[model samples]
Target: MIRLRYATMPSNGGSRTSTGTIQTPPTPMADTSTEPEVQLRMFSQPRFLAAVRALVGTMAQRLGFTEMQCGQISLAVDEALCNVITHGYERRPDGQLWINFWALEGEPTGLKIVIEDLATQVDPDDIQPRDLDDIRPGGLGVHIIREVMDEVNWERRSPKGMRLTMIKRLQPGRNSELKNE
Candidate 1:
């Protein structure tokens, strides 16, 4: 089973809070029929983003994500990558963007994506939804990500960095064998 535990940090002047810890259970000794899952990580770059999009599409399709769902995830991911590249890395172009996608085993049909960057930290409490009435070109990425993903989580890593984790649940009745934790 996978568990998430929220934690508070006192190392950085008590100004930051972590979303949760991700814990995965050890593999079963009896059930050795299934293959191991894979994870992907990349740095901040145009080529990396393109590869991420393709990988998302392929995985979503294989997991039976609807066309709309795939598109929504793609857009949200793009926005997230852009934010990491621009705001997080301060447009350094040479910064790194780490991305990890994994199938949530023994769950109610779900997938999890984790994006981490060693850039300036963004306080989750500081992010506020923009007003719709006020026409503006900026400050819409966070809103869009929240709308598209089933669950969105943000946290600062110790000294310097931020990690964004997003989860999407697939349609019910497709994977009944797995149990939710």
Candidate 2:
């Protein structure tokens, strides 16, 4: 199990457009996969962002994700996790974020990532397309996620919290090679 926590620095307050004191404590998430594939876990925190990128890069390489594809996945994961850290937890620093990654064996679209966070609900309809012409530092996370992942979906759980699912399908030629073996 991968566990990590993040503490917000006073100077960096509001830099990420989050309110309240965020304390993302490390929580252990279960990894029940017998198959060798992608898997990772990190609580809502700023420092863990880099770790997420590294984990994704390693997983992508193992899954035969091309450099470009790997980069896209990394960026997408970052955005998703960031959302959890910022809006999900509202930078309250009192919650945890759980993430899971796996490669769909014997299929062309051989990879999938599920990010589960005990944060506030985010309406899928509220997500709007970003305008490239407008230069801004914020509001690009959702857009980047959608662009990078082949499939993006969200669901709300009872009581509270939300789950974001992202999927990517490899090209047909790559899928064939993976299937033959």
Candidate 3:
């Protein structure tokens, strides 16, 4: 149970047909840049991660993010999805989650990644990155996403579930840094 949709610019050459539809040349930008660009609905399954990563990475690349930044963006998203499956769904493969990708408009152009799940409600206070000194094999999703994205936050939904939001903005000269705010 997984579905993904992205707003891709028209690939048709800039032309007008008898149908009275305008088809512009494909640009590096996507229509989602001005609105909610991508939407993904998926089950709590690990098998779809690879495809998701590829799509996300390509989207980031098209958004004019650097190669390294694109990779980081995809990786952070993967980590977030894994966390939702592992923690929110408690490893239940059938639980459902919704993911949305948004392009922000401002002095610092950016992308916003949001994931919502109804599998379980988590206490925000209990969500913390494990000590890095321990060197554990897992439980590092939060740390990875936080370090990779400019802004990150986790919110508890009413009655049930959780929502996680992460954003990355291209700063002056396309450099990136975590926004402590």
Q: Quick one: best lDDT, which candidate?
A: 3
- For 1-181, candidate 1 gives per-residue lDDT tens digits of 1122233348766644343344332222111343224344455666566667776776666676777888888878888988888888887866765566666656567677777677899788886667778897887888899998899988886667787888888877664232323
- The candidate with the higher lDDT, 2 or 3, is 3
Is candidate 1 or 2 superior in TM-score? 2
Q: If scored against the real structure, what TM-score would every candidate get?
A: 0.71, 0.73, 0.78
Once model 2 is optimally superposed onto the true structure by TM-score, how far is the C-alpha of residue 137 displaced, in angstroms? Answer: 1.8
**Segments of candidate 3 deviating more than 4 angstroms:** 8-35, 175-181
Off by over 4 Å in 2: 1-39, 175-181
lDDT of each: 0.67, 0.68, 0.74
Model 1 whole-model lDDT (C-alpha atoms): 0.67
Clashes of each: 2, 2, 0
Q: Which model, 1 or 2, shows the larger lDDT?
A: 2
- Number of colliding residue pairs in model 1: 2
Q: Mind sharing the TM-score for model 3?
A: 0.78
TM-score of candidate 2 against the unseen true structure: 0.73
Model 3: pairs clashing at backbone N, Cα or C within 3 Å: none
Angstrom error at residue 73, model 2: 0.1
